[model samples]
Target chain A: MNALSLRNLRKIYNNGFEALKGIDLDVEAGDFFALLGPNGAGKSTAIGIISSLVNESSGSVSIFGHDLRRERAKAKSCIGLVPQEVNFNQFDTVKSILLNQAGYYGLSRKLALQRTEYCLKQMDLWDKRDTVSRRLSGGMKRRVMIARALVHAPKLLILDEPTAGVDIEIRRSMWQMMQEVNQQGTTIILTTHYLEEAESLCRNIAIINHGKIVENSDMASLLARLHVEHFVLDLARPIAAAPVLEGCQIERVTDKTLSVAVPKEHSLNKLFSQLTAQNIEVTSLKNKTNRLEQLFMDLIDSNPIGSKATGNK
Target chain B: MNYSIAFRTIVTKEIFRFIRIWPQTLLPPAITTALYFLIFGKLIGDRIGTISGASYMDYIVPGIILMSVISHSYANVVSSFYSTKFQRNIEELLVAPIPNWVILGGYVSGGIIRGLLVGIVVTLISLLFTDITVNNIAIALSIAVLTATVFSLAGFINAILAESFDDISIIPNFVLTPLSYLGGVFYSVNMLPSIWQNISMGNPILYMINAFRYGLIGVTDVDIQMTFIITGGFIITLTLFSLYLLHKGIGIKN
Candidate 1:
């Protein structure tokens, strides 16, 4: 069974704002999925509807085959949501927050305690469990929220911008913890603006814009659609000017680095041979932008406010 | 989901909150009640003497206790729930799988617990001032519980309607405090002119305080049956209204 399914979900605020016009998404069991959208593009609204924090105007939502409207408790029990904001009680201790979250899922005291300890240790918050939540730093607070969401051990975990405010070190640790959780068979859905984070952690992706799904496909299939990739190369020697190479679009970035855009239709062998023929050696080369980011920019620019939906299926 | 566990957790967390900040939540009320008894009952009752068949101090003990219960009950739910809304922690309970009644009962129970606990403390302190007698202990306790429940439900509604911290305090400061003071707490309506007595009958809190006073000293300014009916009716109405708000997600869900 799919971990989560949304069919024709729509939300219209009281102010007559159509935050989510219509969104249909399906997350398979154990899939690490990314839902990407620009600001005010209905990503948070969609997450809110799925978590039952926002009332959807129409359509259906289900978790593990339990319809949200009919079997709300059952459906909610299957999902965990880490919202973009820090919404925990600031006065509450870190330990109490996790325990109370587990209790909300109806876990027994013994089980809640066990899960709380496990989640705290995993989030590296075990030592600071006694501290009030507000006293923690921004990154620690984010980790506390992650631990609270995981304490219930739901079948589906949805994290919205989980690493947004966290530093690199904490973000990496959080990513590792999430990886471990996903490896244990939990279906995880992450919504983030960090395109590289999504490219690194997610297997499949769905990009939403103007409240519509513009692209949904496996990571490989999405990345495979890229026609050209811009790479920055560190040359072994200084290049005084742009390389006059055939079939390779090259521009001088710095004395020792060259920026090159290589089309997928042409192999790197031709570019390397051409560069070598010009008496230039490349020490290191890397893509300037990930394929997902490139496609995301292209999709948003091409699709207007009211346009036909585009998805690879 | 386990309804019992969820309910208990919410109640436990709320109780812990008040207890964690005992100086703010529990102490101020106790000290305030003691001052009321000292000034109103001791200093003022001496000059007023007896109005009902009982001593002046004895006559106001039940009223004093009910007053504390009402204020504490109302204050507990209003402040706690409003803070949850302010801090956005109410979403935790909202997104949980627990039923609406469980959430309502959990929060109301917190208020009831705090109110009753404070009422008991005030009762104990009152003993140092007056040698009180109970005509019907069961009825007295019942009225106290019912009063707390009614006010707690009212506080919940107020919290839901509250948009800011000041909005939560507005009800208590502008309405509740005035009504409680005028609700025949310190002086019976019988002391007023017949015209004013009729107007005092319209105050719902007067029925609650009179019913509680009747339970304590076997005396009442209003009909005991009507008092019970009004208090019971208010409780039922407030409860249904609260449940409807929760179901509709009014003032909570966007």
Candidate 2:
């Protein structure tokens, strides 16, 4: 069964701001689904509804075949939500916060302790268990929030902007931890602006813009359909013109730098051959890491009149 | 612990949050109440004589102590929950799978614990200042605790509706402080005229203060039974409404 299903989800604010407009999505068990969007693209509102935090104006949601409205207790029991904002009882320690989350689910004291220990240790917060949460560093606090969400071991984990304010190293480690968790059969539905992270970690992806899904498909398929491959070239000498290479769209500037796009069916050897033939001595060449930032930008700009997407007023 | 994992977590967080700031939360109130006893009870005892059968010091102790209980309890939850909203931490609980009742109870528990702890300390301090006797231990202790919990929940709800820091101060300054003073904290309701006497009954704190007064002096201007009933009603009603708002995710999830 699908771990989560949203059918015609809609949310209209009191001021008649249509935050989410008839959205539909299904996340199967054990699948890593990345929901991508720019700020204020109705991502938080959608998360609010799915987590039973927001009252949907219309439509229905179900988890493990349980309806959000009807069998809400059963539906919610299987889901955990980590919102984009870093929020925890700052006065309490990491252990107590996890323990409290466990208590909310009605876990026994011994079990809550056991689970709290496991989560804190996994998040590298076990040593700080005795320290008040407010005393932890930004990255450590974010990790505590993650442990709080995972205390109950819910089957469906929804992480919204999980690495928003963390440093790169912590972000990478957190990603690796989430990757391992996702590999362990708990479906992770993530929302982030980090397109490269999504491209690498998620098997499926959805991009939302201006309160609507602009693109949604398998990760590999989405990248494949972009239909353009880009490369960076370092020249021994600077040049100021777009280079001419067979089966490649070349953009070159300055003393020695070159950026080129080759068709997927064509090989870079053609460019090397052309570069050597033209005596445009190549110093170094490299492929950009798997980053879908361009694709995300394209998704947003796809609608020419999508309005200025302003974040939190 | 299963059902209460979330509950215990929220309560512990709330307690730890306040406890970590003892000077700001607990200690000030204890000191203030002590000053009230020294300044009001000692300085003026020679003139006022005694209102009840006990000494004036004994007479005013219950009111001062009850006043502290109501104010601190109400302030703890109000500030704690409002800070959560301001810092955006309440979003964490709003997104959790826990039931509304558990969330409400957990927070209420924190307020009660703080209020009662402060109340206990204040009561012990009051003893050194005067010789006081207990008339009804169970009713007095229960009312003190219940009144604190009820006001804490009400304060939390009000915090949610408030838009700013000024909004938070308006209630405690304009509403709660006035009601508590008029609630017979320093004076008996019988001392008031008929109209004001009836008006005093409407202030829930009167019941609590007067009940505590009765517990200490075996004297009450209002019936202790009615006091119990009022405190009970407020608890049930405030608690249920808070739960309903929580279930509906009022001012948050909604």
Candidate 3:
């Protein structure tokens, strides 16, 4: 059985906005699943429901096959949520925050302390253990939140936009730490606007838009489906007009360079051969980083599947 | 399974907060109740003689003590819960495996302790100005506790509904202030016209104060037994409603 499952999960706010509409998802054990979405795509709402922080209007959510409503405590025990907002008590020190969080899991003093210390050390928060959470820099506070979530040793850890607004150095360190944790048999679920992070870290991907899931599949398969590629050409001499390069489309006009989009299967080799034949000496050539984003944007714009469908099976 | 451990955790956190922020949470009520004792009991006791068939100082003691208890209890939960919301810290408690009732009860218990502590401090300060005779100690103590709990639950609900910092200050400033004063903290409801007196019977705070007053000096502006009934009823209702909201993840979830 999957570690977590949401079947036909629906969330309709009292204000008449449907933040989530029948989203069906599954996280198998030991899978690093990245949930991607634009702003207001209901990522937070989905996490809130699974974490038992928000109630669903209609749906079935099971953690390790335990129905959420029937076995709430058991289901909740297995899931840890690092919210998009750093929601720890600001007045509390890093240690106190983790300890209190463990206490809520009904951990005794000794066990709570041991777990607190371990989690804090793992997140590099041991040195600032005594500092009030609010006084820490934004990155440090984010780390504190991570430690707090992991203190109970939950089987499923959901990180909702954990690296948003964090510095690049902190984000990189956090990514490394997350990788180590994921390797230790915890089924990890991460949500982020950073597609690059999702592309690199997650083997499975699910993208939601406007409160609906648009895509869910293996990361490599989703990127492969795009089958779109781009290559830039450098002319040997300044050409007054745009080059008539076959199979390559001019994407932009810039001084001293031309940005071209090439379909991966249509033969970039032939385009390169043509450029060399025309004495259009290619000074530089590079593939656009994962053309999946363009495909995603195009999908979101034309069909706008996000509005009509809830999610795919 | 062990309720006491959970209870202890809440009580400790609350007392710590009270001691840490004494100037804001503890001192104000102690000072306010002390001034009431000094002016109403000391200066005025000399003019009025044995109002409750005891020393005039004794007549106002229960009101002053219960006043502190109610205000502190209300303030404690209001500020604590609202601050948690403001700082987004409630997620710590919300994401836990603990049951919702436990969370609500723990917070309510904390407010009860702080409210009672302020009540005791005010009672001690009042002793410097007036003498309070404990006619029925158990009843007086129970009433004070019950009153604090009811206000604490009310404050919790207010805090949950409050969306902004200004929202926190508004209810205390307007609704709570009016209700507490008009609840007969100073003068007896009997002094008002018959219609107003009948309406005063509807004010829950009056039942709380007069019930304690009945226990302290053995005199009440309203029926003591009825006051106890009303106070108990309000406490039960508020507790049930607050627990229901917590379980439902009402405003907190949003």
- Measured against the true structure, the TM-scores of the candidates, in listed sequence, are 0.98, 0.90, 0.89
Across A1-313, the per-residue lDDT of candidate 3 in tens digits comes to 6988989899999999999878888889889999877778788889888987788999999998889999987888888888888787777788888877777777788998999999999998899999877899999988888888898898899999899999899999999989998999888999987777888899887877777778778888777766557666566566666667676677535545677777667776787777677666667776555565665676567536445653333
What is the descending DockQ order?
1, 2, 3
Candidate 1 CAPRI-style tier = high
Model 2 segments more than 4 A misplaced: A236-243, A279-283, A287-291, A304-313, B193-195
Residue-by-residue lDDT tens digits, candidate 2, A1-313: 8998888888999889898877777778999999988887888888888887789999999998999888866788788888777777676667777877777677788987999999889998899999978888888987887888888898999998899978999999999989988987889999887777888789988777777777778888778766677878888877767667778888764557888887888877876888888778888877654448877787688744455332210
On residues A1-313, what C-alpha lDDT tens digit does candidate 1 reach at each position?
8988999999899999998877889989999999998998899999998998899999999999999999999999988889889999998899999999999889999999999999999888999999989999999999898889889888999999999977898889889989999998889999998899999999999999999899899998989889999999999889789978777688998999999999898899999998889899999999888778898999998877999878777
Off by over 4 Å in 1: none
Ranking by TM-score: 1, 2, 3
Highest lDDT against the true fold, candidate: 1
DockQ of each: 0.89, 0.55, 0.51
Judged by whole-model lDDT over C-alpha atoms, candidate 3 comes out at 0.80
Cα error, residue A9 of model 1, in Å, equals: 0.8
DockQ leader: 1
Per lDDT, what order, best first?
1, 2, 3
Residue B43's C-alpha lDDT in candidate 1? 95
> What RMSD does each model have against the real structure?
1.2, 3.8, 3.2
**Per-model CA lDDT versus the true structure:** 0.90, 0.81, 0.80
